[model samples]
Structure formats: C-alpha cells, structure tokens
Target chain A: MRLATFRGRDDESHVRRVGLVLGQGDHVRVHPFDAGFDLVELLAESAEWRDSQADVAAAGDGLALDEILLLPPVYPVAMRDFLTFEAHVDGMERGHGSPGVPDAWYDAPVFLFMAPHAVTGPYDDVAMPPDTERLDFELEVAAIVVRDVSDVTPQEARSAIGGYCVMNDWSARDVQGKEMSLKLGPSKGKDFATTIGPWVVTPDELEDCRDADGFLDLKMSVKVNGVEVGTDRSGNMGWSFEQLVSHASRASWVKAGEVLASGTCSTGSLAESWGRNGSLTPPPLQVGDVVEMTIERLGTIRNTVGPREESVAPVAPARRRSRLEASA
Target chain B: MRLATFRGRDDESHVRRVGLVLGQGDHVRVHPFDAGFDLVELLAESAEWRDSQADVAAAGDGLALDEILLLPPVYPVAMRDFLTFEAHVDGMERGHGSPGVPDAWYDAPVFLFMAPHAVTGPYDDVAMPPDTERLDFELEVAAIVVRDVSDVTPQEARSAIGGYCVMNDWSARDVQGKEMSLKLGPSKGKDFATTIGPWVVTPDELEDCRDADGFLDLKMSVKVNGVEVGTDRSGNMGWSFEQLVSHASRASWVKAGEVLASGTCSTGSLAESWGRNGSLTPPPLQVGDVVEMTIERLGTIRNTVGPREESVAPVAPARRRSRLEASA
Candidate 1:
C-alpha cells in the first residue's frame, strides 16, 4: 500500500486528508479516508488497524490523483539522518582535502538530529537559502517509524518501520562547511528545506526487493533539469536500515511519526560527484533549476529551486576579552 | 508574570493545565486556568490575550504550589542550543588539548538541534545514557519564542521571545567526544534527556536585571549534593540572546513555543570546571547524585541522575569495499 497526505486542488479550506494510492501513471487514483484521518495516527495503531484501512481503501472508487496536491506523507515528530554510505563519506572527506573517511566512521552508525519543521511537500518550490551560493540536493530514502521503541536490537528495530519514501536532504555546502568547522552541526546548512514523498510505500510492497541480509536491492537515481547526474543501488549502503535504526534507539526513543533517513548515497550530490570526478561539470544549483529524485517502489519527488529572499546580516563578533574582564 | 504547566499531585488523570505563579517561597501558589489552556498556544497569541489571562489569574483563589506537580514550562516545538559563552568554549578547547577557542567560533553563534522529545520536568530524574561513563549537566537559560518570525533582525527577534527558563542540557561526555571526532553531531550523547523550568519568567519581570546593552546581568550557579561547584555571570556570553535568535532565523522560521538556549555559562558543567582546573575534582556524575542549577530571577531546576538501562550492542562494521564492487 502506498499512502499519501493531500488536499483537493481547488479546495479553499486547505484541509489535509490521508489516502491510499491506487493504479499508476496517468490513470492513477487516490482512495481518500475520512476527513479527520491522519497518517501519523494510523501508523501508530495495531497491524490489524492498517489491514482494516487497506480493506476500506479497496472498496472505494476514489478521486483522480491529479485532483489533489500532495503533501509530505508524514510531518515527522522527529527527524534524524545517518551517513551509512561509505562511498559518499569518502568523497566528502576527499573533497575537503582530508585523506579519507575517519576511522570513527566505522565504529558505529552515527546520525544527526534534523529540524522536522524543515520538511516540505513533494512538488513544492524549495526557496534558495539567503546565505548559500552552493545549493545542492541529496538523493536518499527514509523510513517512517511505526511505533515507539527504545534500546532495541536490530531485529526488533526492523519491526518499527512502517514504510519508506524518497527523500531530498537539501544542502547549502558553503554554509555547512563554515558551521561544521566548530565540530557542532550542519544545522542551518541543511534545515532550510527537505523534500519527501510522492507517497510512502509500505514495507509489504517491497518484500521481493529485500535480500537475504535484509538490504534493499532497489535502484536510486537523481536528475537535475532533465539530466541524469547520479545513480546507485540502495544495497551499496555500508550499514543496513535496521542497524542504523537500532543504533539510533540505543539510548533514545524512536517514536511513531519520526523519520530516519539514509544520508546521501554515493554520487548523490554534486559535491560528492565533484570530489570523485575532480571537476564541477555541473555546477551548484541556481534558481529555477529542477531537481527530481527517485527510489524504486517508493516513488519520486520533484522540486524547483525558488528565489532567495533578503535576510538580515549576522551579528558582528564581540571584541575579544579576558575571562576577568568578561566576568566584571 | 510567571507561567507554568502542572497537574494536581494526586490527579491520576494526569491532565496538564497552564497556570500563573503567584507569591514566592513557602507561600507560593498557582492560579490554574481552564483545563484546556495550553502554554504553547497561549504564547502564540497577542499580548492583549496574555494581559487578559493575567487579569483572570489575579482574580482566582488558586492552588498551593506543593499540591501540584510541575512539568516543563512548555513542550517545545523545536530546540536549539548555542555555544555563546566564550569562557566555556575556551575551557573546553583547552581541556581537549587544543590551545584555545577555534577562529570559526567567533564567526557566528554556532548551535546544534536537540531532541525536543527528550525534555523532562524541572525536578525530574535524568537517565544516564547506556553507552557512557561520564554523565554531566550543563547549566543554561533558554528563551521560548512567543510568535513565528522569519528573516528578522536582532531587534525584531528580541520581541519574539515570550519568557525565559532555566535549562539543564544533560550530556554523556565519552559518547559526545567520539561522535564529534567524526564532525557531524553530539546526537545520541545529549538526546537522552534535557530538564527545563521551575516556571517561565516573563521578560517584563526581569527588566531590572537587564544591562544597557540588553544582556541579562543574572548570576548562575550549579551544585552537586549540596556542594557548590560552579558559578558564572550570564552577561559574560559572547553573543546575546537576540543575536543568537536572529542568526537562527536567517533563512528559517523560529516558531512560537520553540526553545533557543544560551548554551553553558562559564563553570556551568563539571567538565568545564575540570578543564579550567586541570583536575576532575568532583568527578563525573554517579547514578544517585543530585544536580541543582539556579539562575537569578528565572528560578532553579534540580534533577537526580538515574541508573543507566541496558542497551543492545552496536553492529560491527562491514568489510571495506570499493565503490565499483559495492555498486556492482
């Protein structure tokens, strides 16, 4: 089952409704649930509830997919993205003139908390952040948590994922590098906007794509302005999704409606591509450029780069002073 | 005005209600609003609404403070903690064997997104993360946003704050150091729990404490098991709260009920004190130790360190592979 959140295209009230995607391509339709149904709430219920919803969806004739505007399937309660692709880390490190991936990278699956409010819709226009000149997009996939779990093993963690979706972890390379130099975050650098959806494809729909080790053998690709820039197999990830989720829950709760994203895959962004190839063939994104990313079975999300708005300048640095002078 | 969220001491329903704190010390009382009143929603309203609520509060008989259990003043929509204290940063770098603060530290107010779900009540027990041996508490103050604002100047951003509260950003030093070695986050290290509030003190209530430049001249201190270990002036911060808020909203929205923390003040944490003194005099926190942090005018929050829960081991690293081999 592919689930989505959408509002009727011509509806002035702008109320969001959950739906089950039916058919495909131009003939696709959406079986709308009750006006008050929420995907996040539904995902938190028992498996029997989901099956009941699927039964209800099968009975409806539904509305044409083109009649509605798709929003992100779930407005996550919490968001974390992990760098599980070793090739992407290698390229990023080399790009910064470092030797290669840090030995610490192999110690455990590491992740950073992201601003859940930064999420935007599948077909939305991503505003170019005022501070960046090197705007980029990351092609990835994300798993939506089905229920709350903590201190769980990899096997237990796997059961916590309800579905998956294509994700674009937008980036501002210039801003990110400067901020990360302090060893804290890529906070504002990646928090301006993140695109997810077209729809969430439930795990049951991808059973055939899972390998013996539980890695997804799905093709992932990204195209900018009709040009294919990168492609990689999801199975290339250094750590499996279950392992990443398990690591994330080691000391903290992975709550229902939270999103755990697979950080940029190999060649998933222009920065990595430039590092690997040693040339910026296709330069950083400019306003009006279109970015479209897709993961097999999950779906595609396409967004256009919008204009950067005028922003206030950051405060000037305070004059240096001794501890005694500061305390005085 | 002082605002808080609380529930009746014996109320098994556990319904949270917003209230205004009246009186002080042993004579303190809380004027509870209607059952449906939410502090987050109230903050998002106009000043007139706040004044009207205060009027209603003034007319109530109220409940004894000891008869209610206090919760965090607000369950933040988002949380960001900024390292704005130069003294703390200097001590931290020196402790890590670096000469002093990094040059990039002066560029702008650097912050990391924290897990909002980790927040607990002022007097709650903080769970020691399973993966760490060094548990610490950071003494800080946080401003809760009153309204949604974007691309605002420092002056404009200042008005977006509704009130301030004491914050304890709990940390796991061993885990944090290892994660920062990879330069992405202090994620799991600090996400287990954060404690905030006794109650939120409105800015108007602290006007007399403000210096000419708008920096708060408040005294902050921390104690462990009745032994005073750290003290610092809040005005020693290199970046003011307004500046931090402005920088945070450069290209993103700072919404109402979100929290912006003033990081750690000088000598706020055992780790910083150890860094400055070249000795772990008080040592890392033990499971039964009590931590009490106080900010002038804002109030105090006390938490006890609880035992760590057992967690699953992280997955072992996969065998090294070339990009071509992995992709194929």
Candidate 2:
C-alpha cells in the first residue's frame, strides 16, 4: 500500500494529513484519516494502525491526488545515512589519496546521522547556500522505522521497517571537504537540504521487488535539469538494509519515525563523478536547476535549486594565530 | 526569568508544561503553564510566547518544584555541538595522536550534528550501551535557539537564543575512536544518550553572569559516582556562544528550538582526564554509577547510568571481501 502526507493545494494554511492513495483509471484519489493523522506522530502506533489499515482506508474524506501538495512522508526523529556500496567507498577512499578501503569497512557497516530538520518535499526549491561552489545530489533509497527497536539482530530489525522512499541527499562539496578534514561529521555541508517524497510505499507493496537475497533490486537515477548525470542499481549495495538497521540500533534505541538510508549508490553522486574522470567534472548546480531522482519501486522526487537570500562568508576571514599555535 | 518544563509527580503521563521557576527561601515555586500551556509545542513561537510572559506567569496552576518531575526543557529540532575551546581542541588533537590543533580550528568553529532524539530528562537514567569499554561524559553549556535564524551576524544571532541549560554529552570512547578514524563522524558512539536540563534559564536571568568579552563566565564541573572527575570554567571558552550561533546559521536555516552547545570545556571531559594520566582513567562508568554536572547559573543535571538489557556486538564480525573490493 502507498501512504502519503499532504495538504490541499487550495488551502494555503498547509494543514497536513495522512492519506491512502487509491489508484483509479487516470487520476489518483487520496483518502485522509477520519479526524486527523500525523505520520511522524503516528509512527509509534504503527503496528496498531497497520492492523486496521483496511478499516481506516474504508472510511475517510477523499480527493484527487493532484489537488493536494505532497509533503515528505515522515519528518524523522533522526536519520542515519550509511555508505554501503563498496564501490562508492573504494572510490571515495582513493579520491582522498588513501591507498585502499579500510579494513574496518568489511568488518562493520558505517553510517553518519543527518539533520532531521533538513527534510523537504518532492518538489521544494532547495536554497543553495552561498559558500558552496559545488552543490551536488545523491540518489539513494531510505527505510523509515515504524517500531522502537534496540539491540536487535538483523532478522528482528527487518520487521521494524515500515516503508521505503527515494532520497536525494544534497551535498555542498567545498564546505564538506573543508570541515570533514577536521575529522568531525558533516553538519553544515549536508544540513542545508535533503529531499524525500511524493509518497511512501509499504513493504507489502514491494513484495515483487525483493530479490532472493532479501534486498530490493530497484533502478535508481538522477537527472539535472534535463540531462542524466548519474544512474545505478540500488540493489548493488553490499550490505543489506536489515544489517544497516540492526547496527544502527546496536547501542541506541531507534525510535519510531527515524529514517535509515542505504548510502548513495555507486556513481550516484557527483563526487564519484569527479573521481571517475577529472575532465568530466560537471560544474556545480546553478540557480533554478531542476534535479529529479527516480527509484524503480519507490517513486520519483524532483526539486529545483534556489539561491540563499543572503550569503555569509562560509568561513570568516583568517585571523592571526598565537606564535605557539602557528608553529604547532 | 527562568522557564522550566515539568510534569506532576502523580501523573505517569509524560505530558510537559512550561513553567516559570520562582525561587523562595527554602523551596522553589513553579507556575505551571495553565492547562493551555505547551512549552514543547510553542517553542517555534518562542518570540511570541515570550512577549506574554508576564501574563502567563501571573495566571497558572502553581506547584512546588519538588512536587513535579523535571524533564529536558525541549527536544530541539536539531542540535549542533561545536568544538570551541582552544584548550580542549588542542588536548583532543594531541590525545588522538594528531600533531596539533588543525589550522582550521582557529579559522572558524567546526561542529557536528547530534541526535535530537537522544535527549533525556535532567535526572533520567542514562543507559550505558553495553558495548562501550569507556563510558564518558562531557560537561558543557548549551544555548537553546528561540527564533528562526539564517546567515545572521553574531550580534543578530544573540537574539535567537531563548535560554541556557547544563548538557551531558555521553560518549563511548571505543566506538567514537574507530568512527572518527574513518574521518566521517562519531555517530553511534555519541548518539546513544545526551542529558540536558534541571530547567532552562532565560538570557534575561543571566545578565550578571555575562563577561565584558560577551561570553558567559559560569563555572562548570562533572562528578562521577560522587567523585570529582572534571571541572572547568565555561568562561574559558575561546569562542563565544554567540559566535557559535552565527557560524551555525552561516549557510543553513537554524530553526526555532534548535540547540547550539559550547563544546566540552577544557578539562571538562573524561577524554582529558584519560590523557593527563592513563592510570587515572577512572574505571568506565558502571551500572548504577551516578554522573552529575553543575553549571553555576544554569543549575545541576544529574543522571544514573543503567545497563542495556541486551548487547549486540558493537562491530559486527568481519566478512570476506571481493578480490577487487579487498585490493581497492
């Protein structure tokens, strides 16, 4: 079943509602929750609500899908984006002048947490921060947690996922490369924007998409303006999403509504693009550039890039350091 | 004045209320935010709600401070923990085997986004993830953003802060070291728990604590299992909270209710203690161990460490790599 969060286009107030998208002849219909529903707020009660999905869908105010403005399926309480594709990791390692993939990559699945507030809809205009010389896009698949899970095995963790969606993890190359050198997580570099949405597809709806290995074999691609910039198979992830979920909850409780993303696909980002061929580095995004991403099973999410109203110097002007500090 | 979020001791329901903390000789009086007050919900409207503060304080269901359960003031939209103090940075760089504090540390502040979902009450039990051999706590001061701000100057950013609180940034040294070695982040290591509270003290109440240099001079200390482990003056921070805030919003939108933390104070964390004397590395916190933090004007936040019910291997067992993957 496909679930969606949306607001009536006619209502500028933007009151959000959870809806069941019923596919009809040519137009799609949305069945909103009886009184009200908040996707993020309802994640904790997912199992219960899921049990009565039929009843809830049977009764609700319905409208044409085009009559509503869609919002990201869920505003996750927290987000973990893992670098699961060995090819991508290898490319990144070599790009940084490192000899080879670290021994630990195979020993454990690694991930970084993203800002929950950076989530935007399928078509929101992403504000290009002034400091970034290269604004790039990442295409990946995301799984949203439905139940509170902790210290669970991969098998048990598999059940905690409620649904899937396409994710565009936006990146600011210049700022990211500089700060990451300090050996901390990417905060400002990737915090400006992350796009997800159009709709969420439940696991049950993708029964046919699952491979024998229990991974989704979805085709993922990214298009900038009208040109195709990157494409890859989502199923190429070396580590399964189940392993990612379990490792994520290893020591911490992954609360309802948290999102876990399969790291960007091999060749799914522009950084990998630059590493592949020095002469082929696509210049960063320009204002009004349209970026669209589509995952075979998880629908499409497209966004337009916009410029920040004002630009602050990404890094303040350098200042004199203490004699000892400079020498060190 | 000082604002607090609390729940009645008799109510198992964790519903939170915003209250004004009025100090009396022997006890504290809490003016409950009447039946209509929602501190967490109204955080986005911080500036507006702050306007009618006088009226809200005048009329409310009042209770003794001890009669209610104090919770973390607010679960922010996002959290930015900055590595600010030159002392702490230099110590950490040396401890990590790096030659010196990176040149960029002086150029601008660098920070990582923390899990907003990890927030717990001031007195909550912090479950020590079973995997950590070194359970540690970081003592620091935090300022909560009350208004949406973007690309603002330090002067303008000052108005965005709603209040201040004592923060305990719990860490698992083992996991953090491995992750940071990958040069990505300290996600799983630090995402497990972060305690904040006692209550929020608004800027208006902190006027006397301000120094001529525009930084707070509050004394901060941490005690483990009733033994003093770390102590430092928050005023010793080289980067002011306002500078942290302005740098935070340099390229992205810092939404209302976001939290900006002054990185761990010099000698205010166990990492520093471990470095100073390897033998003095107090045994990693054990189950039932108590950890407490006190900031002069903000108040104290104490938490007991609890054991995780189950333990998953912190790092999953290693698996074979492909020929191409192994050699990269």
Candidate 3:
C-alpha cells in the first residue's frame, strides 16, 4: 500500500496512489489532488484502515501525479536518523585529528532525531542556510517506524518498520566538519534540512527488494546537473536495517510513523570525493542546478536548489548572566 | 506569567503559575495542558479559580516541588538547539586535530532540536542509555520561541523568546567522542536524553538575568552524591541568547513556546572535560544518586539517577531500497 500527504486549496490532502509510486504522483496524495481530508488526523484515527490492504486500495486517487506538490510522507510523530555508514565516518575522521573509531561501529548503530520542520518534500526547494556556505547532501534510506517499540529484538525491528522512502540527508558540510571535531557531537551542521519521500512503500511490497546478502540490493546515485558525482551498492552498509531499529529502540521508545534514516551511503556525496579541499567551491546551488538522486526501487527525486534572497551576518553573543559569579 | 507542563494520568497538564505576577504567595495558576489546546484556547477555556501557593513557597519541600513533575515548558511545534560556546569549539577542534573554524564560528551559532520524547518532567528518571557506558550531563539554558520568525533581527530574537528554563543536555560521551574523530556530525551522542524544567521563567521576569556580556548570569552546577563535579557561569557562552535565537530562526520558522537549548556550557559535563582522559569517573548511579542542577531564576531540578539495567543489543540496520540506488 502507498500512502502520501499533499497540498490542497484549504490544507494538505491525504490520498493513496494507484500505480507504482513516483514523486509527482506521490505529492497528489497530500495536496492539489485533494482526497478532501486531513491525513495526519485521519491516520491517527483510522488504525484499522492503515492495517488493511483492501482498505488502502479502496482510497480514491483524486488526480494524476504531475499536477501536485509533494510533502514528506509520514508527518512523523518525530524523525530520528542513525549514523550507520563507514565512508561518512572515514571522511569526518580524516578531517579531525582524533584516533579512528573502533571497527565495532559495524557492531553498534548511532541515531538522532531532526526537528519536524526539518522535514521537506522531495521536490521542495531546500534553503541554503544564511550562516552556512558549505552545504552538502547525503543520500540515504529512510524508514517509518510503524508501531510503538521499547527494548525491541532484531525480529521486532523488522516488523516495526511501516514502510520506506528516499532521504536526502542534506548537510552543512562546513559547520558539521568544524563542530564534530570536539568529539562531543554534531548539533549545528545537521539540524537544518532532512528530505524524504515521493511516497512511502509499505514493507509487504518491499520484501522482494532484499537481496542474498540480507540487505537491500538498491543501486543509489546522485548527480549535479546531469553529471554523475557518486554511486554505491546499498549492500555495502556496515549495519543492517533490523539492527538500527533495535538499537534505536533500546531502553528508549520509538513511535508509530517515526522516520529513521540511514547515514550517508558509500560515495553518497561529491564532498566525499571532490569537495574535501576545505574550499567552499564544490558548487553554489543556483536556481537551475536541477540536483537529482535516485534509488532503485524508489523513484527519482529531482529538485532545483534556489538561492536565498537576503542573508544576514551572525548576531552578537547573548547577554551574560552575572549573578552566578556571586553565588559561586 | 510562568508556564509549565506537568505529568497527569492521561497527558501533560498545562499550568500557569498565578502569583508569578503578584510577587506575593507561591500560588500556581493551574490548567489542563493539552497539545490540541493552543495558548488562546487554554486561556479562554480556563475555569479553575486558582490553586494555593503555600505548598510551594519553601524550597526543598519534597511534597510540592518533588511530587509535581516538570516537562520542557512548551510542547513545541518545532525545536532547535545550538552549539555556541568558544570553549566547546576549541576543545572539539583540539580533539579533531584541526585548526579553528573560520570566523564563521564567531559569526554564526549552530543548533539541533531535542526529540519529541525528550520532554521530561523534573522528577522523572533520566534513563542512562545502555548503548554507551559513558553517560554525562550538561547544564545550560533553554528558552522557548514564542513568535513565528523568519530572517529575524537580533532585537527580534530577544523579543521572540517566550520564556527560559534549566536545560540538562544529556550526552553519550563515548559515542560523541568517537564519532567526532570521523568528522561526521553528532548523530547518536546527544540525541538520546535532554531534560529541561523545574519551571519556565518568562522573559519579563528574567530582564535582569542578562548581563552586560549579553549572556545570562545563571550559576550552574551538577553534584553527584552531594559532591560537586561540574560548575560554570552561563556568562561564558560565546553566543548570547539573542544570537542563538537569531541564528536558529534565520530561515526556519520558529513557533511560540518552542524550546531551544544552549549546546553545552563551559565545563558542562565530565564527558566534555575529563571523559577522554579517564579521570572523570561518575560514581555509578546506585538506586539513589541524587543528581541535582540549579539556575538562578529558573529554579533547581532534582532527579535520582537510578541503577543501570541490563538490555539486549540494538537490532540490525533497516533494509536498503532499490529505488534509492537507482535514483542515485
């Protein structure tokens, strides 16, 4: 079953797609196509409808795909992304002088949640933040946690996933590279924009996509304009889907429709190969960059990165609290 | 007016401390906290005449202060926390073996949001995640954004803050230290648990807290088993509250009562100071390690860090997608 949220005249409309899910078609599920209802409230109210394949199939298609705008499917109760890739690790390590991480990284997965506004539709224009000049993109797989989970087992992780979508874990290369050096964490570089969807493909239909290695056999690629910059075999990821979910749900809880994204895939971005010289010159996205990314089962997501009209200098530091000194 | 969310049987109950304006009794203006009920709705629907303040006037009164749980004041539509301390930047840079970040470091502030589940009450047990054996606490200030802002000026940033609270930004020291070496942004380290509250002090009441340095004068300290392990002056922060708010709200739309935490204050935690050296050994939180933190105007928050529990390892990573690869 395919589920989506699109924009209509009054508000976002929720709809179901009839054919193979694609970006344009997916947007219609939420908007302009106007299934004539609120998807967020409806999804929360109709638990049985979400579970039944027949009920999902019966939801009408209001219009053809091209005429609509796409919103991130799964207006996630929250979104958590994990660091499960090796290349991204290597690149960051080389930037910092610290010793390398234990190979056990493959043994354990790391995850964090991005803000809800950080969620943008596949074709939406990502704003180049005013404070950042080194913005980059990360290609990854995003899965929606379908149910509430606590202390989940590997098997349970598999079942917890409701569906899958394409994620462009957009990054602030400069800010992230700088702050991550502290061995403390990445707070600024990542929180900006995290993009997902076209459509959410439920697990039942995605089972066949898994390959012999027990990982998905998706072929992933990213391009600037029409030039290919990166490519990778999804099977190269150090950890499996089940492990990420289980690790994320350990002690803590994961809620229904919460989106989890896999960190950078191998060769996920040009900065991994070409843009590492510390120069902010990989490319400034203009109105016509037409940057596009594609994963085998998921359809292509193409967007034109536009420039921000007015950017401001950073404001002065906050007022210092003086009374603490006397108390101390 | 002081606003807060307390844990009730069904959901977090919203309450407005009444005498806060009168400066007389410890009276609290209580109301049902509902996400569905906006501030206007809550104010309009409020019918409860009032609640007594006599129970809360005295400090360390276990009955009133300890029993009433505290959640991050606003159930934010969105949240963004920034890393703006020069001390943290220098320490992280040293760890990475990299040069100082460009003037951009002084020019802009970086931030990420606490997860939706991160909203914790004052007395609730902050779970020590099992993934990383090294858990640490950071004492900082967090304020909620009360206005919708885009390209806001520094002056606007000041006006935008609805209220302030004590923020305990929890960290997985080991995960963060290790991941930063790779130069990847913080994914796992800070995502887990970030606790805020006791209560939110409105911007009007905190007018004098901001000193000439343009930062708060809050004296912050963390004690484990009654021994002082960390201390800092909020005045040491490189970015002021206004700068942080301006940076966070630049392009993104910030909402009313949305919480934003200062990344970490100077010497905020053992992990940032001595965890790498193995000199900072936090006595394991036995069934009764009373961990408490305090900020001048905001108030003190006390929670007993309980004993660690055994847990299973996280599940495998999620299955990859073919469409993702194909699109790439």
A1-328 in candidate 1: lDDT tens per residue? 8889999999999899999888877877888887798887776667688879867986987888678899889888788988888889999889888899999888887788887777899999998897788999999989999888887888998788888999999999888989897778787898799999998888778989987678877999999998999998888777778888788887777888899998898889999977776777579999999999988888889999999877789687853447448576
- Models sorted by DockQ, best on top: 1, 2, 3
The candidate scoring highest on TM-score is 1
**By TM-score, is 2 or 3 better?**
2
lDDT per residue as tens, model 1, B189-265: 89889999999988888889987678877999999998888899888877778888888888787888789999998
Ranking of all predicted structures according to TM-score, beginning with the best and ending with the worst:
1, 2, 3
Report per-prediction Cα RMSD to one decimal.
Answer: 2.6, 4.3, 6.2
- State the lDDT of candidate 2 residue by residue for B32-89, as single tens digits: 7666665544443555566587366757656886698888888877888888777777
| Reference A-B contact fraction recovered by candidate 3 | 0.30
Evaluated against the true chain A, what TM-score does chain A of model 2 have?
Answer: 0.89
Query: TM-score of model 1 relative to the true fold?
Result: 0.93
DockQ of every predicted complex: 0.57, 0.39, 0.28
Worst 10 residues of 3 chain B by lDDT: B42-51
Candidate 3's TM-score reads 0.79
- Indicate the worst ten consecutive residues by lDDT in candidate 3 chain A: A16-25
Which number leads on DockQ?
Answer: 1
